[model samples]
Target: MTVRSTAPKDTLGEELVRFDGVVKRFRTSLGRRQTALDGFSMTIPRGSVVGLLGPNGSGKTTALKALLGLVRADAGTIRAFGRQLPEGQALVASRMGALIEGPAFTASLSGERNLRLLGELHGVGAETVAEALELVGLTQAARRPYSGYSLGMKQRLGVAGALLAAPELLVLDEPMNGLDPEAVRDMRALFTRLRDERGMTIVVSSHILAEVELVCDRVTIVRHGTVIRDGPVGELLDRGTVHTVVRVEDVTAARSVLERAGLAVTAAVGPQGPELHVGATAADPGPALLKVLAEHGLYPQELRLRQASLEDVYINAIREADAARGATGAAGDVG
Candidate 1:
């Protein structure tokens, strides 16, 4: 099918990939049909790192596979590089590279040799393979056989393979998997440099929310085969509620006081012991919460407003989507 470019005209730059209302279904071993993608849509802007995040079995891999034409969607369209997919896949194949799930290689071959073989197929040479290995910090382990490498090393090798072609659009699924803390940090920096120095558009799907928040410019959170939330990371986090965290000698008493004052409260055991989180509806709820607690003869050791973290935003988004869906179903039943 011919897919037209529906990207908005802008100085920012045209979107490199667009999956519009895509739908994919599969038959399970139990003879039941399961929907893998339900009207899923996403736009990948040029020179940006977009994080695709979702829970397990939430269609994250399915969507990425569909984008790479590894699987066909029963409906909807996928356009990339101003060209229709599958039909134009060959034309744009050289410009795109991907590492899905993991990389496969001859176990007996050295890491460097595996990359070299992969590069050779794409007309890439030894120099490109070496550079890719170095970029992923795999230079020291390059001569080691694939079977001898650790899990983290294997992950780095996979990343090296994806970069072998110097692709303009790189798609990585769980790129941070099997990486240590230091390797994770290095990978984050590498992704940033690829976007800044190489001007590449990277689409990364990962369960590592904090890393995604740190490295990605934008994020799209999906659930049940559809997008629940999609926007710039900063914008989405900034729009979240600023919660008031209270650490007091009497946790139960503080919670009672806050709840009685018509404030929403949740109690949990933090690093500092029992803590109460009060939803801050006003610009500053600290003073009000403090005053109310004082009246009850309870003193707070600390009360602070905490900005929402990416994890908080993700949880809230999933909850909001579930609530909205429930409401829709309820309305449908009434009608």
Candidate 2:
């Protein structure tokens, strides 16, 4: 593992990384001003996994790039290791590793050889390389040529390289891209092990909400370069915010009844059959839904209350952002 830099340590309870009111702007080819990051702010705590989530172009990459000094923010404050960014970037980066987009590996080199070549540049020794390989469980195949390795194996090697520094913080953007289901599951477990065993703080950027929910301690959803939602998975979808799915004999009639009652209704497919998602209200929404459907001469073949998934929370956040944008755009035209 690489030696930790002597950068000033963070005070207790202070986040490992913090961005406050960060802004970044770009100009389109046609000379129009395009804001990629606008008032974007987020924090990553020590010994935690934080996911940067949003649809494509929601500024997830821009945020990460700004933190790593790959891109400069036009305004706002950023910190790493309790010190300001860019200035602290050199020292702090010495104690962190990242796999942004796709890692670059020499196709001609073996997995272990590639890591060794890169590690040598960073002063990482053979022992550390072996340990990193073991950590990522790439020891047996380490000698295999990089070109022959499967996508998952290549990814594991990338992680092994990132582990070279035994970094206190690991920043990965869409690390799970192009992996099969099994590989995805394996990678998720690997990231968890890194945090629980190494006390490493991780900041991952991804649009895959379901996996993010499973892997991240907290999630931040961004839209139009602004944070739309940020919280632990359960907190965003609290017990009070559960959804009820109702599959009725008449989909149209049941949907109309639910919507007419002032509750949000969305057509969905439940585990058992076609269903409608009804937002929960009060103590128990299941009973109330049944009562309403009965009043409308509609009965559901199946009715159940389900906890909201991370995808549900993400979708709601984006939808709300879209509505807000629409309203603001309309208001701008009116006056």
Candidate 3:
């Protein structure tokens, strides 16, 4: 499939958040200027699940903090729910539930009490707090002291606090940071429910690519404070040409047969069995490859097509960036 230069704008339909060439910077203790974000621009559509992914110090948090008005952008514009941020920050933030670096609560207080206090601060009632607890599957742990709660429980409480106000947007930074496998699965299900049932637009930021793959409808990958890839999860994964994997009893013979058939064999490896990666021009290469293998009496155990994963794409983008930087350095030295 041919790759498009630009992503279709109407994919999500309505805009809930937008950043126009936003730049943020700070001064270090020694007085050197540090730029955290430079000309960052993005638009998050309403009611869509978006994954914000980056390595540590990639400005993912900076982008979120700027949108929330916790940090001001040195240049450009930011808007949330169609209003300029911080100016309408109170109004916009009131409609947003966020746990940027985990939620804070009194360790001595019970889960219910902590949420009760948070609800009162948000001008919500006790019933809202109880419902939020139930929504995050914390009802059974509601009476437990915050000090005794597990890391997962604390994360759930953070989510509960976000839900207390029935906000339109949910921005969670590493919500699954310390969660166990079961807790991660539960959180995934809860996010799905919140999106499909309640129609809440959720933005989840995490360094875990697989979890993001499972939870997000679309993903934006950032590296060194820049977005390298942004598009639908399916389309992004479907980028580049197609390839097939063949698992056969005789790896060597299979390679010979495929090569003779004019198929480009990209990779071949195996310990328990032999495997060959063949570049394909068509979707189904099974019939042609199978016939070639059969001619040599090489019956294959398995044959499947493989696509580049988000992790693979992300690594490639970073490698390209590194190469570009190196090239620039070399040119400067020559000059």
Candidate 4:
């Protein structure tokens, strides 16, 4: 099955990381080859917060690890900070920091000591260590042994380590995994501050669609080891077909009124009463829609617009991929 991306071509002069036809492969059980990534290409803009979303076994982690030089790609070129990766990768990676899975720390070491050791490795001074701890809201727990910290606190300490280098690019994989609701909110604020105040570029990978929608400027979705969608979050949201539910006193009359005005109405009974579902256009439906309804004297008691959400898009992409694969298998059997 082939996955075709619907994303538009990105304009020049905006890319920070560029991958052209990148692929990665490994040996699987029974000595068969498995492809983790296939022709994955993308250009992440500088200083932009991009949400990398995919379901389990979708190769999101493989893509990130390739960027960090932890795994080498079998084909294609990856350029970061205007240089080819894994060669000038050291110099380029120095300007980047990441929390790939979770914090790896000595159980006996105090949080502060662990941070100090990381700071030293990154050439960060003592003052920088203190600042990193404060930035992650881990200053109070800085003196406690890492083994005593909760899962959320351990995640925070990992974030602090990532910040210790004061990197230009930060890559986080499920940074909010163990966080509570309040902590998730706090993490959002921290990401905003990092981009607004410090001018940092962030690539966050998560399965939490709503949180990604709230925080990301743009998103790139992958499924079955291929990129399915990539674009501005707002554009994707706006492209959704608007579905409006309307409740009126006269259900039959309401349908006639809306139909005459060229609005598609479906007769479906809602909680309030029989309602009409309107599938509005891709563009704005406000002025023309309201004028038509008002002209017909069908006073709607309730009117609400529903559209596809980030989760909707995510699910559809994966389902489409599965359907394509099923069709291909059927064709192969026929052949």
Candidate 5:
């Protein structure tokens, strides 16, 4: 479906949302205080898909809640559309929509009816509701009772509700939680269409790093309630280590040669036969690797370069963050 919006284009690609040094804490049942967010900060560019990614208990959801004004921050500042939050939430309420955790619906009500009810509350028109349903690929199943809808179908309906108001900024937490492969593909396309066709900015928080890598223009990874990595997907990926896969007959010999040459090597079986993966510490270790392999009479049948995946970068970032935290804690104990 062609989704078009005539909303003001003056601020397209500009900073639409900003979270600065935000801090949030909660009191657990045991009377211990938990830091949900500590100096968390991020910015969402207008008309772009930004991925808010982190492991469990990484303050992703808490940051979203604080932005929506569902919870207040003890410190730091948030601004949406250049208006300070909490004070200006009402003014920008009509421009933002969010689906946090999972959405709830009346069991007996049909999906169409549920969305219609939401439209009524938001002063949205019936045609808009229909458009939303079609945009989310739920038109055929729109009449299905909410109780009978599959998990993926329910997620689609929740997304349709978020789109009902034609919001400018959409925040979705774990939107792909229960979607099947096909549904995930459709949702990714929907996000692209929303950004390209409708010119809407999106903030998606999910643990699916691969999906985030495919759909997000920029990624912000948080740990211990603070951002440890934040940049455009391309820039971040390029900053990671380069990998070269060498297909050779003598895999064991090739591994020895590469490792002795100061390269990290691993073995794996590929489509043809055994292959050696060389993690190049230096940039462009291709020529040097080939020379060394030829020197040892272990010529490569085929050699190819591979870029680091988002998952690889994410793992390294988390490990580094954890190691830093561990060292800090040790120093504190020493003190």
Candidate 6:
């Protein structure tokens, strides 16, 4: 298996990881087959931090496991770099680092020693361990026993261990779990540094949508073991409404006029004054909004446009998937 160096012109960078129509199912003790992945397909671009986001049981971890060869898919091809899965995983794994759900180390050992041990597994030397520790802001705490470190420090150490390999790609699952607000902020900065300095690709699966929006260049959202949406974070979120918030002198008149013009409008007391919350099409909703406001002789003292958040896109995707699944189930029952 070889790494792919060139990406499609349309993508941000090289193609690092790809899952095509992958399927995996687990049989319960009662002999019920639970589908963990159903024809899931996603491509991770190189040198970009790509968020792999989904709710629990949405197969986020399962997808990572398959990509890393920690688990085999019942069906589908998993590729790392350019090499296809299982067969290419070893070669690609060498260029990749992973810190899954929890940090695992000999608790009694010092953080530095634990890193050394992990380094040995990858034939990494002491210098590499030191660099990794320094990179993850663990240099000062490296000599402390793993059990004595704070939860945030432990998370940082886990990240340090992953970096010991100086991998071309890093896979982190809920890396900021158990972190304080400051710690989360620091971790986000570190990921940005990794992308900016090392040009490493990252696949992060996290429940924290806000953090993902801050650090990820793009995102692949999964639900019901399949892709609900995949694209640049900005693009996916922009697919939603462009809300134009206006502070007008008259509330009732503005609302009536805007509503008559087919603009969905709501009102609330905002920081400045009474605000008109208007939902418009994905395109620039400003000009059309102004036209309607001017026609009604309503002038806005303040106007602001609020782009939809990634959370909005995520929740809607899940809702749509649920509706589709319910419809499918209903059709099956009828048959």
Number of the top TM-score candidate: 1
RMSD of each: 5.2, 3.9, 7.3, 8.1, 3.8, 5.3
Model 3 lDDT, residue 304, Cα = 84
RMSD of 4: 8.1
lDDT of 6 by residue, 110-163 (tens): 999998998899787888888888877788988999999888788888888877
Q: Write model 1 residue lDDT over 169-234, tens digit each, in one string.
A: 899989899999999999999999888766778999988889999999999998778888899999
lDDT against true structure, model 5: 0.87
Cα lDDT tens digits, model 2, 1-335, are 54444223454235778889998887767776678888898888887889888888788888888888898888998998888987788878877788876778999899899999988877888999988888766789988889998877877788778888778889888888767787788778888987776677888887667788898998898988989898776788782258787888899888987888999988987677778888878657888888988987888888888888888788888888989989887211100
With candidate 1 superimposed using the best TM-score fit, by how many Å does residue 134's alpha carbon deviate from the native? 0.7
Give the TM-score comparing model 3 with the true structure, all chains together.
0.80
Which candidate gets the maximum lDDT versus the true structure? 5
Clashes (backbone N, CA, C under 3 Å), per candidate, total 0, 0, 0, 0, 0, 0
Better of 4 and 5 by lDDT: 5
Model 3 lDDT at residue 85:
77
Model 2, position 219, has a per-residue lDDT of: 86
For model 4, residues 141-220, the per-residue Cα lDDT tens digits are: 99999999999999989998888877778999889888888888888889988876666789999887899999999999
List model 5 lDDT by residue over 1-335, tens digit each.
Answer: 22336346777768989999998888877776788788888899899899998888888899998888899999999999899999999999888888988889999999999999999988877788889999888999999899999998998899999887778899998999899999899999999998888888999998888899999999999988889999999999999877898998878878888888887887877788788778875667778888998998888888888888898799889999889989887211100
* TM-score comparison, 4 vs 6, better candidate: 6
lDDT of 3 by residue, 1-335 (tens): 11112213453448888888877777777776777776678778776889998777777888998887789888989998789976889877777889988878999999999988888887888778778888788999999899999888898899888887777788998898888888888888989987766677899998778878888888887755557778888888888456788998778888988898898985556464558888876878888888889988998898888787777677767777558758766211100
* lDDT over C-alpha atoms for residue 263 of model 2: 92
Prediction 5 TM-score vs. true:
0.88
**Model 2 C-alpha RMSD to native:** 3.9
TM-score attained by model 4: 0.79
